[model samples]
Structure formats: structure tokens, C-alpha cells
Target chain A: MLIDIQNLVKDYQMDSVDVAALRGINLQVQKNEFVAIMGPSGSGKSTLMNILGCLDNPTSGVYRFNNTDVTGLNDDELSDIRNKHIGFIFQSFNLLKRMSALENVELPLMYAGIDKAKRMAMSKQALEKVGLADRMKHRPSELSGGQRQRVAIARALVNNPGMILADEPTGALDTTSSMEIMDVFKQLHTEGNTIIVITHEREIAACCKRIILIRDGLITSDTPNLN
Target chain B: MQQIRDNITKAILSLIDHKFRSFLTILGIIFGTASVIAMISIGEGTKKQAIAKYQDLGVSNIIIRDKDMTDAELQTVRMKFSKGLSVEDAKVISDVVPGVVSVSPQSEMKMEAKVGDRSAKASVIGVTPNIVSILNYRTAKGDFLTTDQYDRQLKVCVLGASIARELFSYDEPVGKSVKVEDQWFEVIGVMQPKALFTETVGELASRDLNNDIYIPLSTFNKRIPKVNPFTSDVKQLTVKLGNSEQLLPAAVVVRSLLNRRHFNNDDFSIIVPYELMKQEEKETRIYNLLLLSIAAISLVVGGIGIMNIMLASVLERTQEIGIRRAVGGKKKHIMSQFVTEAVVLSVAGGIIGVILGVTLSLVISWTTAVQTTITLYSILMAFSFSVIVGITFGYLPAKQAANLRPIESIRHE
Candidate 1:
């Protein structure tokens, strides 16, 4: 198993009231799996993704990545896990506005302390993989919605992490751009990459090999997608 | 090292992205550093000028001047058997005082000097041969009076530079005959112009030295009749000491001697240039300290301005900070990034401030009578102070930036 979670609970303090965002969730993910976590608004799906991505720690639980207990790790250790093992892709793309596509892709590598020459080479290869080889010099404001998402994907893939955790990866795209982004995900899955996407759309969930449905902070259904 | 370089590059790029905002942010530091440099330079220049003026007065010399009085006062002093400041006082100081190098006595009488039809009001000063060496006077043309001339009581005189120019125009005044009052005296030398004394020292009145004529004391006493029978033989006595360390002691000895010789009458005052110089230095030290504190306050205020801007910057870039934190940037990385930004701003401001300060000092010297000296240490101090201010003020904002929670900040939007 690449990811293991047990009895995960997250509570947010809101104006003197403890709101349970995630209630006693248990999950396990195997290597090279394409998984989609589906839920409506306020179902705690984003909170779960945040915990899974090592961006946030659970209030109480055991999270093991590659057999290492991650829940007990400190802030810097968690950042290292996020940098080396889990890559994040957001719905809004989150590409740095002032940087070109290549520079945005190079950001993670730069944080990883890679030298300039190799960082450039790796970022270029990632852009080529995302079919954005010619748009490397274009800034986020200069690119269309689909192209910006492609740059985000290139950035996520540049570090070659154990898993790519994308939250609502196609939530802001048109049908045509959505299909294009989904095709890229399918191609990456065929290339033996482990992927987990959080979304609410049924069509987006149907593209994954397995789907987990969450309602009211609990897992409602976990099964292989028939599509 | 590489991390620091990357952070610096990011800082510079971000500042360049918002050019006008960055410039405004550093304005306080610019003015602070410039004022610091300017203030210190002005203080230094004032000190140097004071020292030069004091040096011209011969710091190791002590002067005694006769008190100016009306004829009634002079008659009373004579009735009391006090001779005022006479050549006998100079002879007594030279003979009795220990560590006294030399003594020169001088007397002045204001009269009209004429060459042909051109005439100028000049103070005819009668001095002994040793007066030139005692007072640092130099002759620009011909030679000064010798002991032979003084002993022989020759009616020769040394014309002051301005008096020579006034009477003779461009022609050499040496060996020319000039009518002084009712007597015709031959000019043997002309003196170089001396620095003007604008303020009185003790009982000594300020006067234009370059308009005076110098003659042998023996000739002056025989030719120039006394304005009043109660007047003293000489007006002033200049006593040179072996070294500056003996000035106070010699002054004390000379004062007591004069008091006795004048029959316990307070008719003369002693002025020690070295003591006056030391007193002036002490006063200016307090003044310089006050100026430095004011400059320091401005720098602190400039530092506060940097903190204000940096705090706002951290707030506005919360999302950016989160993004950077999410991308494997550690807390130290974030902290150093912002700190480097602050340092860059201040260093740029420091360079500009140095340039502005040098220009300001130059402009001050050119436009006003007040002198300004820009020293290397002042520049270095101002520049380093600005850097220190940046780091000090930059710490709080950078810590706030580093301590932000990534999860919350990422979703701040």
C-alpha cells in the first residue's frame, strides 16, 4: 500500500464551536491506482484531500505513507513529504502569476535544491509530457484556461513524486478543456503514475479506475468504477 | 548558499515588479542616511574651522592687553602710579617667568598715511624686532625690521599689504617714502595679508591687521607724540611659551607679575589661546553629540517606516507565502527571503544616500559660508546604520511571514 489511514478525525474551531470536518475515516490506496474521491459541498472531501496530501495533520489518527507514520511528523517533515512524495494540483491552477510556465514548473525542483541546469532540463521534459512544450515561456495570464491547467500539471509532474493529489482538477474548465485534461490524466495513468483526484462531478469521477463517495464526513461507498 | 541566492533573486524580482511601491518604501531610509552624513560632515567642518582659527592665534602663546579707558580713567590710573601695559611688563615677564620663550611688546596709534595725494587711515604699529618671530608675521616684499634698525632707532617702517596697495597701487612700496601724521618714514618691507579677527578677545579689540604699518618702537616713541600724558608706553605684550603645557602656569605667573607692577591695579587682562581652544572643543563636543542623536532618531524613524511597509507586504502576500511554503520551502527559507528583500531595499537606499549626502555637503559649502567636510567614516557609518536598521525592523515582519500556517494561508485567496 502506498497510503494508509485509520480513524482519521479533523475538527475546526469556528467561533467557540468544534465543527467535525472529517469523522473517523479509514482508507488504504495501492500503488499505481487512479482513484477519485467524490462528494458534494461540505462533505469534508477537501479536508480529507488536504490531510492526504500532507498539507495538514489530522487532529487524531494514524497516517502511514510507504509504511512510515506521517501523522506524528513535524511541519518541516511534512513539507519534505509533500515535496518528495506527494505533488498537489489545485482547481484554480495556482501557477505563480509573475513566472513563465517553465519557471512555475521549476519551482518545486528549485525548492528540492536542484542545480539550475538539471532543473531546467527536468521542467522542460515535464512540459513536453503535458503537451505544453511550446508554451513554456508564456506566463499564466497569457495562457488560456486549459493551458494554465496544463502548466500546473507539468509542475506537479516535474518532481516525479509517489502520487499526484489533485483537488477538483477539472472544476474550472469547459467541456472541451475538461476532456483534454482528463485525457492527459488517463495517459499519465497508463504510464504507471499513481493519481488521486477530489471532485464532485459524476463524469469526472467516471474517468477514474476506482471511486470513493463521501457524505456528512463519512465514506458512503467505495467500489471500482464500471465505466 | 544556493538557497540564499534564490531568495535574493526572488526578492529583487518582486521589488522590480512593483517599482513605484518599492521606491516609496525606501524613501525614509534614504533621507535618514543622507541627513546623518550631512550632519556629521557639517560638525566635522565646524571643528576643523575652529581649529584653524585657533591655530592662527598660536595656541602656545599668551597675550596681555591694556584695558581701553577714557582720559579720566587713564588719569586716575596714573595718579595711582599704575603705568598700564608697558614694554617694562614684557621685559619683566621674559626675565622672571620660567619657560617663557620670548616676549614682544607693541603699541598702536591710528593716523593718516599718505603717498603723493592718495591717503588711507592706517594704524601705525610700533613693534620690537622679535615681534615677527613671536607672532608668525611674514614679509611678502623685502625684509622685516632687524635688531640693528630697532637699536639704531631708524625711521624706517613696514607697510601692510592693503596699505601698500592703497597708497602705491601696483607699484612696489618698499624703499618709498610715506608721510605718517607729520613725519616722513621710509617703507622697507610689506607684510603678507593676515586673517581678519572679527570678534574681540578679552580686552583686545578686533581690528583689520592688514591696514597697519610696522615701525621700530624706539622711533615710534620719539616721533609719535602721546595722545595723553597718562597713556602707557606699549598697548599689548605677546608672550610665547616653550610648549603648550606651560601656557596656564605662565599665564598665572604673568598675571600676578602685572598686578604687582601696576600697583595692584587691574589694568591688564591675559588671554591663553590654548585654553580657549580646549574650552571651545569641549562645547562643540556636546553640540556634536546632540546632532548625532537627532540623526540617529531620524534613522530609527526610517526603520519604523520599513517595518510598517514590510508588515503590510507580508499581509498582502499571504497567499504567495503559502504557495512558497507548500513547495518545500522551510520556515527559514521564508524568513530569509523577506529579510533579504529588506536588506536589498536599504542597501540601495544607502548607496543613493551617500551620493546625495556628498552632493548636499558640496552644495552647502558652495552656497553658504559654513564649511562642510564629508569623511569616509561618515559614509561608512551611515551605510552600515541603514543596513542594521533594515535587519532590525525587518525581523518582526519576516517572522510573521515565516510563522504563518500553510494550510490556512493556501486557502486565503
Candidate 2:
């Protein structure tokens, strides 16, 4: 299993009152599985994504990633796991505006302490994989919405992380651009990379190999996509 | 090493993004460092000038000058058998004081030096020929007075550089005769110009040595008539000591010996150039400390300015911090990045400040009479001080930037 989460509980302090963002959740994801986590607004889907991405801690649970217990890891160790094992893609295509596409793609590798020359080559290869070979030097503002998202994906892939966790990665794009992003995801899945995309859109979820629906801080459904 | 380089490049690029803000931020540092270097230069220059002035006075020498007093005071001293400062005092001090090298007695009388129709008021000083060695003076054009001249009481004198130029504006003074008051004296030599006297030393009045005339003391006593009946035998004694370590003790010995010989009349004062130089150095050190402290305060203020700007920058770049954290950057990495930016800012400021300070020192020395010396240690000191300020002030904001929660910041608009 790439991720084995058991009875995860997450709580929040909203105006001095205990509010549970994710409650009593048990989920497991295997290697090379393309999964989509879907939920409406305030259904705790984003909270789940935060925990899965190692950006936050579950109030209580066992989160074993790559067969290592990830719970109770210090901030630096969590950062290490995030750097070497998990890659994050954001809805707004969070590419650093000041950096060129290639430079943006090199961020994770830099955090991994990769050598500069090898980092450059690896970033270039990642960008080329995302079909942005000609746009390596272009900044995020200079690229179209789809191209910027592709750059974000290239960044996610550069460090060769075990799983790609994208939270509504195509939410800011037009329909055609969203379709192009889904196609990139499909190609990566076919290449045996485990991908987890968090989105509420039905069509985006339909393209995944398996889908899980979350509601009211609990998993409502989990099933393989038949089409 | 690569991580640090990456942080530095990132910092540079980001600072370049807001060039105007960066410039404004480092302005305080520039002025602070510049003032540090410039003030130190001025202080060092002033010290060097003082040292040169003392060197001209002879650092290993002590001087005793007769106090100028009213006739009543002079009569009171004479009645008490105190004939003021005399040649006997020089002779006794050289013989009695331990570590004494030699002594030369000198007398002065203001007289008009006339060469042809050109006339100038000059102080005519009379001294033994041995004064040339005791006071370390040299003749520029011709030889100084010989012992034969002093033994024969010859009416021959050496004109001071300024007096020579005044009496012989178009002719050579060494081979000519000049009229002093009513007596005519042949000019044997011209003395080299000495440093200008701007302050009174002990009881020695502030007068230009270059405007004086040098003659044999026997000639002065025989040829020149005293206007006042209570006039002392000689005006001053320049006592040379063997070494500076013996200056104070030798001065004390000479002072008490003179006190007994003159009946404790308090008619003379002793001045040690080495002691005066030490006092001046102490005063300059205090003054330099004041200047340095003021400069240091400005550098601290500059650091505060950097801190303020960095705090605002950290706030503005919240999203960037979030992105980097999400991409696996540790808190230490974020801290290093911001601190690197601050260091780069201050180092840039330091370079500009050093250049400005050196130029300002040069300009000051160029345009004014004040001297300025730019030392390498001052440059290094100012530069390192700025770098330290950058690090000290940069840390807080970097910590703030590092501690920012990534999830909330990323979700922030």
C-alpha cells in the first residue's frame, strides 16, 4: 500500500468550539492506483487532502506512507517525507511567478539537495515530459492557464515522488484546458504512477480509475470507475 | 553550498524585483557605514598632524620658558633674588639632572629687519651654536653659527626662512648684511621653515618660528641693549633628554632645581613635548570614541530600518513562503533565504559606503586644511559591522517568515 490511513480524526477550534473537519475516516490506497476524492464545499475534502499531502497532522490516527509510520513526525521529518515521497499540485497552478518554468520545476529537487547541473537536466526532462519543452524559460504569467498547470505538474514530477496529490488541479482552467490536464493525468496513470486528485467535478472524477466520495467528515463511497 | 547559493540567487532576484524599495531600505546602512569610515579617517588624520607637530617640537625634549610678568611682578622676583630664566639654569640642569643629554639657552628680542627699502618685523633669537644639535634644526641655504662666532661675540646671524624671504625678496640673504634696529648684522645662514605654531606650549607664546632671526647669544648680550632694567638673562631653555622614558623625571629634577636657584619665585614653566603628545592622544581617543559611537548608533538604526522592511517583505511574500514550504522547503531553508537577502542588501550597502567614505575623505583633505587618512582596518571594520547588522536584524523577520503556517498562507488570497 502506498498510503494506509486508519480511523483518522481531525478537529478544529472554531470560535472556541470543537468542530471536527474529518471524523472517523479509514482509507487505504495501493500503488499505481489513480484515485479521485470528491466532495462538495465544507464536506471536509480539503481537510483530507491536507492530511494526505502531509501539510497537516490528523488529530488522531495512524498514517503509514510507503510502509513508514508518518504520524508524530516532526516538522522537518514531515518536510522530508513531503520532499521525497509526495508531490503537491494546486488548483490555481501555484507556480512561483518570479521564476521561469524550468526554475519552478527545480524547486523540489533543490529542496532535495540535488546538485545544480543534475537538477537542471532533471527539470528539463520533467518539463519535456509535460509537453512544455519550448516553454522552459517562460514565466508563469507569460504562459496560458493550461501551460502554467503543466509547469506545476512538471514541478511535481521532477523529484520523482511516490504519489502526486493534486487538489482541484484544473479548477481555474477553461473546459479545453481542463481536458488537456486530465489527458496528462491519464497518461501518467497509464505509465504506472500513483495519482490522487481531489476534485468535486463529476467529469474530472470519471476519468480516474477509482473514486471516493466524502461527506460530513466521513467517507460516503469508494468504488472503481467502470468507464 | 548549493543550497546557500540558491538562496542567495533567489534573494538577489527578489530584491531586484523591487529595486526602489531595496535602495530605500539600504540608505540608512550606507550613510551609517560612510560616517563610520569618514569619522575614523578624520580622527586618524588629526592624530597624525598632532604627532607631526610634536615631532617638530622634538618628542624627547623639555622646554622651560620665562613667564612674561608685569614690572611689579618682575621687581618682586628680582628683590627675591630670582633673576627669572637664565643661562645658569640650563647649565645647572644639564649637569644636575640624570639622563640629561644637553641643554641650549635662547633669548628673543623683537626688532625690525631691513634690507634696502624692504623692512619686516622679526623676533631676533640669540642662541649658542650647540643649539643646532640640541634642538635638531638645520640650515637650508648656509651653515649655522660657529663656536668661533659665539666666542668672539661676532654680530652675525642666521635668518629664519620667512624673515630671509622678507628681508631679501630678490637677493641671497646668506652673503648679505641686514640692519636689525640700529645694529647691522651679517647673515651667515637661513634656517629651514618649521611647523607653524598655532597654540601656546606651556609659557611659550604662540609665534611663528619662521619669522625669527638666529644669532649668537654673546652677540645678542653685547650688541643689543635691554629696554627694561628688570629683564632676565635669557628667554627660554630647550633641554634635550636622552630618551622619552626619562622626560618626566628629568623635567621634575630640572623644575625643583630651578625653583631652589630662583628662590621659588615661580618665574618659569617647564613643558614636555612627549607628555603633551600623550595628553593630546588621550583627548583624541575620547573624541574618536564619541564619533565612533555616534556612527555605531546610526548603524544600529540602519539595522532597525532593515528589520522593518524585512518584516513587511515577509508579510507580502506570505504566498511565496507557502509555495516553497509546500514544495518541501524546511523552515531553516526559509530562514536562510530571507537572511541571505538581508545580508546581500547590507554588503551592497557596505561596498557603496566604503567608496563614498574614501571619496569623502579625499574631498575633505582636498578642499580644506584638515587632513584625512583612510585606513584599511576602518574599511574592514565598517564593512563587517554592516554585515553583522544585517545578520542580527535579518534573523527576526526570517524566523517570522519561517514560522508562518503553510496551509493557511497558501489558501490566503
Candidate 3:
């Protein structure tokens, strides 16, 4: 198993009151599974995604990644795991505006302490993989919305991590741009990359191989999306 | 290494992006560093000038001068059996005082020196042949007086630098004839240019050493007549010591001896150049301290300015920090990046400040009477101080940037 979680609970302080964002959830996923976590707003899907992405600590849980318990990992260790194991993409395309598309794609490897020549070659290859090879010198502001999102995806794929965690990746796109993004995801899935996307859009969720529904901090349905 | 390079690149780009803000941010550092170098240069220059002035007077020497007085006052001292500072006093001091090297007596009479119808006012000084070695006086042309010529009472003289230039504008001064107050004298030598005292030193009257003529004491005594009948045989006694450490005790001994010899008339005064130099050094040291404290105050204010801008920068770049953190940048990475940015700002400011300070020093030396000296150490000290200020003040904002939560900041607008 690539990821395992049991009895996960998350509580946050809101105005001096303890609000439960996640209440006793259990889930497991094997490697190379394209999964969609579907939920409405305030349904705690983000809280679960944050925990799984190693961005936050669960209040209590057993979270094992690749058979190693990650629940008790310190901040630096979690950052290392995020650097080497998980790639994240966001809906609004959180690309640094000051950098060109190539530099944005090179950010993760720069943090990994890779040298210049090698990092450049790897970033170029990643951008080429995302079909953004010609737009490498363009900044995010100079690119259209779809091209900017593609640059963000190139950044996410640069590290070649074990899985990609995307939070509402298509929520900001129009229908045509969203369809084009799904086509890219289908190709990535065919190439056997494990992907987990969190979104409330029905069409985006249906494109994944597995679907998990969450409501009020609880998992309501788990099924293979054969559509 | 690559990480650090990237961080520095990002810092330079960011600074270039906001040119006006960066300039405003480092204004305090620029002024502080400039003040540090400029103030120290001015202080050092003043100190060096004072030292050179004292050194020209001879640090290990004590002077006994005849008090300026009216003829009535001179006659009163003369009747009281006090002949003022004289050749006899010089002889007694050299003979009786411990650590005494030699005593050279001198007499001065201001008169017009004429050469080929060209004339200039000059103070004609008379001295023994030994005065050259005792006072370290050097000649630029020919030689000083010899004992043979002095004992024979020859009417030969040496011209001071300005007097030579005045009496013979193009002709060679040595072996030429110069008339002084109706007496004709052959010039045997010309003295080198000496430093001019711009201000009065202690009780010593300010006068140009370059505008004097030197002649043998025997020739002066036989040919020159005293304006006042009650005037002493000599005008001043210059006493040299073996070392500077013996100056005060030697002065005390000379004073007591002179007091008894002159019957306690107070007709003469003793001036120690070494003692006066020490007092001036102390005064300048205090003045330098005051200037340094004011510069330090500006440096502190500059550090605060850096802190203020860095804090604002952290707030503005929250989303950027979040993006980096999500891409696996550790807290230390973020911390180093921001600190590097601050250091870049200060170092740029420091470089400009050093240039300005050097220019200010040159301007001060040129436009005003104040002298300025620029040393390498002052530049190093000011530059290092700015770098330290960058690191010290940049820490708080860097910590704030590092400690920001990636989850919340990524979502922040």
C-alpha cells in the first residue's frame, strides 16, 4: 500500500471553540490509483487533503505512507517527505508571478539542492512533457489562464513524486479548458502516475478511476467510477 | 550551494524590482556609514596637523623666551639684576641639568633685507655654529656656519626659504650679498622650507620660520646694536633633552635654576612642546568620542529602518513564501533568503556610502581649512558595520517569514 490511514481525527480552534474538521475517518489506497475525493464546501475534504499532503498534523491518527508511520514525523521530516514523495497542484495555479514558466517548474528541484545544469535540463523536460516547451520564457501573467495552469502542472510533475495531490484543480477553468485538463490527466493516468484530486465537480470526479464522497467530516461513499 | 545562489539571485531581482523603495530603505545606512568614515577622517586629520606642528617645534625640546615688555618694564628688570633669558642661562642649563643634550641661544631682530634694490622684511636671527646640529636645521644649498667662521666674527649669513626667494628671485642665494639694516653680509647657505604655524602654540607667538635670516652670534654682537639699552644679551634659549621622558623633570629643574639666576623676576617663560602636544591629543580624543557616539546613533536608526522595511516585505510576500514552502523549502531556506535580501540592501548602501565619504573628505580638504585623511581601516570598519546591521536587523522579519504556515499562506490572497 502507498498510503494508509485509520481512525483519523482533526480538530481546530475557532473563536475559542473546538470545531471538529475531521471525525474518525478510515481509508487506504494502493499505488497508481487515480482517485477523486468529492465533497461540497465545508465538508472537510480540504482538512483530509491537508493531512494526506503532509501540510498539517492530524489531531489523532495512524497515517502510514509506503509502510512508514508518518503521523509522528516532525516538521522538517514532513517537509522532506513532501519534497521527495508528494506533488501538489492548486486550482488558482499558485505560480510565482516574478519567475518565468521554466523557473516555476524548477522550484521544487531548487529546494532539493540540485545543481544548476541538471535542474535546468530536468525542468525543460518537464515543461516539454506538459506541452509548454515554447512558453518557457513567459511569466504567469504573460500566459493565458489555461497556459498558466499547464505551467503549474509542469511544476507538479517535475519531481516525479509517488503521487500528485490536487485540491480543486479544475474549479477555476471554463468547460473547454477543463476538458483539456481532463485529457491531460487521462494521459497521465495511462502512464501509471498515482493521482488524487479533490473537487465537488461531478464531471471532473467521474473522469477518475476511483471516487470517494465526503460529507460533514465523514466518508459517505467509496466506489470504482466505471463511467 | 545552489540553494544559496538561487536565494541571492531572487534577492537581487527583488531589490531591482522596487528601486525607489530600496533606495529609501537604505538611506539611514548610507548616512550612518558616511558619517562614520567622514567624522573619523576629520578627527584624524586635525590630530595629525596638531602633532606635526608640535613635532616641528621639536618634541624633546624646551624653550625659554624673553617676555615682550615696554622699555620701562625692561629697565625695571634690568635694574633688579635680572637680564632676562640670555646666553648665560643657556650655558648654565646645559651644564647643570640632568639628561640635558645641549642649549642653543638665539637673538632675533626684525629688519629689511635688501638685495640689488629688491627688499623684504625678515627676522634676522643670530646663533652659535653648534645650533645647526642641536636644532636639526638643514640647508638646501651650501652649508651652515662653521666654528672657524663664527670665532673670526665673519659677516656671513644663511637665508631662510622665503627670504631667499624674496631677495634673489632667480639668482643663486649662496655666495650672494644681502644688506640688512646698513650691514652687508655674504649668504653662505639657504635653509629648506619649514612648516608654517597657522595658529599660536601655547605662549609662543605665531611667526613664519621661512621668512628669517641666520647669522653668526659673534658677527651679530659686534655689528648689531640693541634697540633698547636694557635689552638682554640673548632673546631665547632652546634646550634639547636626551629623550621625551625627561622633559617635565628637566623643565622643572631649569625653571628653578632660572628663577634663582634671574632673582625671581619672572622675566622669562618656559614652554614644553611635548607637554602641549599631550594636552591637545587628550582634547582631540574626547572630541572624536563625541563624534563616534553621534555616528553610532545614526547606525542604530539605520538598523531600525532595515527592520521596518523587512517586516513589511514579509507581509507583502506571504503568498510567495507559501508557494516556496509548498515546493519543499524549509523554514531555514526561507529565513536565509530574506536575510540575504537584507544583506544585499545594506552592502549596496555601504558601497555608495564609502564613495560619498571619500568625496566628502576631499571636498572638506579642498573647500575648508580642515584637513582630512582617508585610511583603509575606516572603510573596512564602516562596511563591516553595515553588514552586521543587515544581519542583526534582518533576523526578526526572516523568522516571521519562516514561521508562516504553508497551508494558510497558500490560501491567503
Chain B TM-scores, listed for every candidate in order, come to: 0.91, 0.92, 0.95
Model 1 over residues A1-227: C-alpha lDDT tens digits? 99999999999999999999999999999989999999999999999998998888899989999899998899888888888888888898888899999999999898899988999999999999999989999999999999999999988888998699999999999999999998999998888889999999998899999999999899999999878
Tens-place lDDT per residue, model 2, B1-413, is 88888888888989999999999999989999999999999999999988877877789999898988898899999999998888888889888999988898988999898998999999999999988887678999989999999999999999889989988985888879999998999998999998887777655667888998999999998889988889998998999888999999888888889999999999988889889889999999999999999999999999999999999999988998999999899999999999999999999988998898899999999999989999999999999999999999999999999999989888766
Interface RMSDs of the predictions, in order, are 1.1, 0.6, 0.8
| Between candidates 1 and 2, the lDDT winner | 2
Question: Could you give candidate 1's fraction of true interface contacts?
Answer: 0.55
For model 3, residues A104-141, the per-residue Cα lDDT tens digits are: 99999988888989989999998898888999999999
What level of docking quality does candidate 3 show?
medium
Q: Judging by DockQ against the true structure, name the best candidate.
A: 2
- What are the lDDT scores of the predictions, listed in order? 0.90, 0.92, 0.90
Clashes of 2: 0
Flag clash pairs in model 3: none
Candidate 2: residue A117 Cα off by (Å): 1.4
What C-alpha lDDT does candidate 1 achieve relative to the native structure? 0.90
Q: Worst lDDT window (10 residues) for model 1 chain B?
A: B195-204
Off by over 4 Å in 3: B133-136
The per-prediction tally of clashing pairs is 0, 0, 0
Report the lDDT tens digits of candidate 3 across residue range B6-32.
888889999999999999989999999
